[model samples]
Target chain A: TQLLEQSPQFLSIQEGENLTVYCNSSSVFSSLQWYRQEPGEGPVLLVTVVTGGEVKKLKRLTFQFGDARKDSSLHITAAQPGDTGLYLCAGPFNFGNEKLTFGTGTRLTIIP
Target chain B: GAGVSQTPSNKVTEKGKYVELRCDPISGHTALYWYRQSLGQGPEFLIYFQGTGAADDSGLPNDRFFAVRPEGSVSTLKIQRTERGDSAVYLCASSLSLAGATQYFGPGTRLTVL
Candidate 1:
């Protein structure tokens, strides 16, 4: 099975600070997706990167896919309390694989 | 149109009992999916349905876990002889199609086995 490991499993930072989470795997994926999840709610898709070395920004959040399509990263600029939640990266092993393999998870707590 | 929705927001069951979880996808979405999320972990894919047929169920942990999408819009996940290890949040998602589609997820049902 393809596995995605995330770094800094838990992070607690004060509001207005900057932080980044990383997702890495040995297997290459056709695409990668980032998601944010809050308590009592399902995860919401933040971004999807299909091209290697692609970078996408969503307001305070920025995402980057590795040049090899085997890793990705999420950077939050000037974090807010609203950003405190679980951040996950997911993707399938290859094309035609509908089931997504998710990263372990990064729990971020922004102290306001 | 509404987002995907799962019934019985929380379920507490005894070990060895059977339970059923239901999901209602967004209006007109033909692809429904089931996933399980444990605390401190991301969602693990359990199954996927394209229309009314299960396109892939390889993620299911064992035979005790079964799911069905009879009408292509709503789905049910059934678990037999639930175990404490089975305790987790069951998530449902739906998309217009399965090929690299963006899936919309439901709040999920928290199932606790004692």
Candidate 2:
């Protein structure tokens, strides 16, 4: 099975601080998706990056897919207390795979 | 329903008992999926259903776990002779179609096996 590993398993920072989380995988994926999950809720999709060297921005959050399609990253600027949640990265190992391989996940806490 | 919905938000059962968890997908969605999430871990794929048939069930840990979707909409996951290790949150998701469609997940059913 394809494995996606996320670094900085746990993170805590003050409000307004900036942080970046990384997801790395040995196997390449056709597309990658980033999700943020709040406590007691299922993960909500934040963005999906489909092309190599692709970058998409959502307000204060920026998502980037590596040129080789084997890695991805999420950068949050001026983080707010509302940003506290678990972040997950998921994708299919191949183009038509129906199941997604999820990363270990990063739990971020933004303190006020 | 507005999105995927799971029944019995929480379940508590003892070992060797039979348990059933239900999931209701969005209207007209052809693809549904089941995943299990242990404490502090990401969700693990369990099964996928395309309409009323199970397209793939490779992720099921063992024979004790079984799922069925009879009407092309509602799906149920059944666990027979459950073990203590079966405790976890069971999540259900649905997508318009397989390939690259976005999946929307339910709040999940937290199962506790004693």
User: Residue B46 in model 1: shift from native, Å?
Assistant: 0.7
Question: What are the runs in model 1 whose C-alpha is more than 4 Å off?
Answer: none
How far residue A88's Cα lies from its native spot in candidate 2, in Å, is 0.2
What is the lDDT, from 0 to 100, of the residue A70 in candidate 1?
93
Q: Number of clashing residue pairs in every model?
A: 0, 0
Model 1 — TM-score against the truth? Answer: 0.98
Residues B1-114 of candidate 2 have per-residue lDDT tens digits of 598999989999999999999999999999999999999989999999999899889999999999999999999999999999999999999999857999999999999999
Docking class of 1: high
> What CAPRI class is candidate 2?
high
Off by over 4 Å in 2: none
Superposed by TM-score, candidate 1 places the C-alpha of residue A90 at a distance from the truth, in angstroms, of: 0.3
Residue pairs in clash, model 1: none
* Model 2 C-alpha lDDT per residue in residues A61-100, reported as the tens digit of each score: 9999999999999999999999999999999887877787
| C-alpha lDDT of candidate 2 relative to the true structure | 0.94
